[model samples]
Target: MSGQAAIVAHAQHWSGTPYHHRASLRGAGADCLGLIRGIWRAQCGAEPEPLPDYSPSWAEAGRDEALWQALMRHMTPAFVPADGQVLLFRLQSRALAKHLGIQCASGAQFIHACPRAGVVQAPLSAPWARRIVARFTFPAVFDRME
Candidate 1:
């Protein structure tokens, strides 16, 4: 397994985790960002900073791209799609980029904690692909070994 594979493996382990807003506990509950947080903890230890409480419509409620700015602070931008990349998505054309998911090993699918389905793997379909606004790699990727 490569470092990216290792990261995806960590995310795969949360496959059945229930979705819970503002929570990160696997199995019990986790939102999309919470799933990313859990994977970060598994691979990089403590989070660089605590996150403020946010509602489901947080991005729409504000014009600021808080999630994108925060991701920039903690991870490296990935110019190409690859396994284990953090994918940021904008649900609407003018909405702030808020949704997140981890690219799976296949690179054609992603794992996300969904409100309706909990943690599930979905294909990188055309519609989903279009929503992707950015990709990033965790800070710990450089230190990880296969």
Candidate 2:
């Protein structure tokens, strides 16, 4: 019931979900947030709150720490690790962090929904590594359930 094991289970639940902007439906369409939300329900049994609709530019709005603040209120933060865990990244140094993905496989790779890849594993190379800003663990209650 470690973060890695739970994340692997969550990642499996997202397999084959097609990419779709602002969508979150398993095996049909889901963007990155959608995938995370779906898995959150699978493991936690309920979403803590509703997510407001957002435009990509929401990250650039003057006070853009909205998403990070949301995470802070809900998910438990995890130590940074190469193994599977929830990850948040700052798209720009001066901007509020807005992207998310799951660390995968010994921290060598991650699975994220991207424009080019719906959900594919990629090496945690320098560029990707540089963007990472925070790590979070799923609720400990979920770990106990596992």
Tell me, by TM-score, which candidate is best: 1
Give residue 114's lDDT in candidate 2 (0 to 100): 67
lDDT per residue for candidate 2 within 87-121, as digits (tens), equals: 88877767767778888877888877765567666
lDDT of each: 0.86, 0.73
After TM-score superposition, what is the CA distance of residue 35 in candidate 1 from its true location, in Å? Answer: 0.5
TM-score of each: 0.92, 0.85
Over 4 Å off in model 1, which ranges?
58-61, 142-146
Q: In model 1, which range of ten residues has the least summed lDDT?
A: 137-146
lDDT of 2 at 145: 29
- lDDT at residue 13 of model 1 (Cα atoms): 83
**Poorest stretch of ten by lDDT in candidate 2:** 137-146
- Name the lDDT value of residue 55 in candidate 2: 62
